[model samples]
Target: MQKDEQRNIILAIVLSLAILLGFNFLTAPSEEELAAQRAAFEAEQAQLAEDANSGDPSTPQLDSTLSAIENAAAGLTAPLDRSEALDQTPRIAIRTPKLEGSISLRGGRIDDLTLSTFFETIQTDSPNITLLSPVGSLAPYYAEFGWISSDSSIAVPDSKTVWSSTVDTLTPSQPVTLFWENGSGLRFEREISVDENFLFSVKQRVINNGSSATELAPYSLISRTGTPELLGFYILHEGPIGVLDNSLVEVDYDDLQDEKLIQNRTTGGWLGITDQYWLTALIPDQEQSVQTRFVYTGKGNTTRYQTDYFYDPVAVSAGETVTFDSNVFLGAKEVTLIDDYQEELNITDFDLAVDFGWFYYITKPMFFALHWITGVVGNVGVAILILTLAIKIPLFPLANKSYASMAKMRKLTPKMTALRERFGDDKQKLNQEMMNLYRQEKVNPAAGCLPILIQIPIFFSLYKVLFVTLEMRQAPFFGWIQDLSAPDPTSIINGFGLLPWDVPELGILGFINLGVWPILMGLSMFLQQRLNPQPTDPVQAKVFMLMPFFFTFLLATFPAGLVIYWTWNNLLSIIQQALIMKKAGVPLGRQPDEA
Candidate 1:
């Protein structure tokens, strides 16, 4: 009977693993689905090429040529390299503390930009992160603000129109004014000013000197050519995102492609496309009613994704001037900076762009705490350590009670063993005896699990903070941990880099490349487990003993920062449990006598 029960337990564990693996296999995209996606992408590309050559009336071309503007409405006839595209048009240089790029004079667009403070890699001379490329470049991404006129006879600034700039370069303290005039009595002037950070203040003024009242709407758009690469994680949102009507809206690139367009009318909000760590959004006037849209279009050999907004058309009377005030955010998604902008600019839920996950209440404050610690200590790794201690202090009373209960149970292990031996064959009687014993001893066997349960949400929140927040990216710790956001680099396969050769890539069995931090985490977990009460059943005890090893392999692929946190948290638990055991008069070295 015991052998049969053990076999059932083994079978149950096997079946559970099978179900998990089978679920993943069933949910994953099949080869046929991948092939179909490729075919669809190719078809889209072909249609775009055809539309470009056929002069599709719906396309929004950005070329300055009159024929191109009248025919194609999106972009250039052929794609050019970034440098070549920038050289094709005159530009006003933009120099800031954190950004270096140029504003395209041809379309009066903030097109070419690179994050001066961020690099593509951690190497000393790695290239800076390129944020926006020119319209004719391979991956054209840019922001443009202008006026749109409903009257067919009215001439407004199109992509083809070149505007003259008042300044040679745009800086923080110095603002640049761009001027353009229509042959009919209308003048457009855009004053662009940038702060030390990522915000761009755009004040667009339009004057009507004509002998008639003309109506026009102020509009701004952020356009990106081609679908950007995504991290492919469900936890992070990458694509078009906006806050409209006090609600956040996120649209995936694939979903947008299928839907084609998503439109909303809100009195105050912001709309834009977002990458994993970077953002480019348009903030329309907070008090004015605006029509916002997240649009995807395939034109020419490339596909373009755009988020734009247009204010209601205002009638500009003869000899009267009208102005529109708006802003653009283009740069890294820093936590504090985004929060500050959310309050200062009164942009609703602007901080949601950072992907703080479902536990925003916990995750945001956790990030702020870690950020504060990191600022003071100058090391994020150390900040994690400090934060762990800070978290432990508040939960001390609960943990102490749990440990005391575990200590009592540990002392009763011998009595449990005797009960099992006497009623070993009668499972029903054994359970009843165990309950009576627990009642007589004034001990709750389930008490030890409380600490583990409490750790679940805290664990997930910290994971979210380390995974999504930009502040945790590329943060260095001591001894070969250069990027806490990435998995540990020192794998056991290469003796933690003592040997020169490295392990070959293992797709599904990646945990085989166990790292030093994970091993330490497992060790710490084992020590903590030693302090807890042991299971009376032989099979259960063995399974419980193997849990630490199992979790070590399971979490080997997580970020190093998280592994460090777990290791530190386990060590703290071990110390707390040991102290509680001492106070309860339970021997720390006592082991359960299964015999």
Candidate 2:
């Protein structure tokens, strides 16, 4: 009888897993896939805008030339290919160990940049991820530093201004100084210096050698043309973000478009447009008071997301030189790199560029833990495992106490069952007696749930770490899990490729992926649940029994690394709970052993 009951329990768990796996086949689409759908929709919208504005006006422009550029987007602002537009622009080469691109000499714009370390795909030979593109490119994104003079006659550098440079290339050790002089005798020189990584120090100086003193405010702007389709996930912020006067601020592109503009005047902060993995931020003088804006301008088919800042006006006397120094950050949001810059350069909250969501406290610490372990272990997957263990250490005492309470409840079940039978239909009396029993035994039935609830944030924070940061983008694990940031590619329906039949792309129903790691995860979850006595209430027991199976299937299509972590977490939890159960002398079975 004992063996049969065990077999039945085993069979039930297996059946649940199978049913859940089938349900997974009908699961929802992933964010990346949804993003593609949104892209298509946006493309259609762009076509409609072009048709509607074929001869219409109301499209605002910065100047008449900007209006001409937008109107002649066919051959100017909106080019089909980025390379074509880039080739047409006169650019000074920018080369660094980590980054390679060009500064467009036409507008003195840092527009063409590609991260040498990051690739579009896992394939080693794949093209590098393009960070900044020229103004006429598909998604025009670039940063430019200029003078915003209170006096309009000073002839501050414009987009059409052709700056002359002495150097052919801007390197880490070699700085490039571009000089452009107005016929009015005022000369502007910008000396640009880049670090080994992404930080670019632009020191702009104005020399009033010809005439009277002029008042000028140094300004920097990062502008992106066309609303690049965002991930659209509320938890993940992908748009304008800044730290103004020690307070962190973030704004969505669509939100800015709807509201028109968001302006804030503060002492100092860094502001920029951030994507899921890539970012381009304009960092102003850390100590100077400045006004920043997350502004949007939509005209016809052209929409621009611009994050700009202008320092308070500085007066430059005749024969005097006024210098303004600021930094521009353009690269992948690597945790260590950003945090290092934040600490070393004294840039306020630079690491916040990677969206850690509302629970940044938990998320950042968790990422740091994982990052530290990755350095030691040399594998992000194993690093994640160590991080999981590290997080569990702090909650050990709480979990131990909770488990002890559960064990005590397990021992008192018989008396409770007898009391239930005695009470019969007397509901109020039964409740009072149960409360009295609970008080006397010093047992809280809800105690065990607290530990489970705590894991929610830890799990969510880990999810955020895996989702947004490029550090883990193509991080690999053991067999079948190449990218920690991507879903498992292997599926059970195809017999793991043993059978020749192809499985359909199950969009959101990715749980149908049913990879090897998910199967192990399901098993670990089952074993964890078995560490405790089953609930006496049939409905509760059934729900508890099926949860592991449901989650196993549901998470199968998730990032393989997360599933691996989940499985490891469940296994650790099972061991922990079992040790606690034994230490507290809790009965393994529902009924106490009968001799």
**Whose TM-score is greatest here?**
1
* Distance from true location, Cα of 433 in model 2, Å: 4.5
TM-score of 1: 0.90
Model 2 C-alpha lDDT per residue in residues 1-595, reported as the tens digit of each score:
1112223444554554454454234233365668675876587457534543231111222332222223323234334467777887788999999998999997798989999988989886899989888755556678988886545566878766789998999999999999999988789999999999989999999999977888877888887776776555556777888988788888876688797767787765698988889889888888888877777766655566678877777888889999988999998888888989899878888888888877889888888888878889999999988888887898889888877876776677677767767884787787788778888988776675655666666767777788887778999988767899887777798988688887777666656778778888888888777665455555556766787778867887667777878888877887788777778787565464211
Which clashing pairs does model 1 show? 60-73, 60-74, 61-73, 61-74
TM-score against native, each model? 0.90, 0.86
Candidate 2 TM-score, C-alpha based: 0.86
* Candidate 1 residue-wise lDDT at 439: 85
CA error at residue 293 for candidate 1, angstroms: 0.5
Residue ranges of candidate 1 with Cα displaced over 4 Å: 1-78, 299-301, 590-592
State residue 166's C-alpha deviation in candidate 2, in Å.
1.4
Q: What is the C-alpha lDDT of each candidate?
A: 0.81, 0.75
lDDT of 2: 0.75
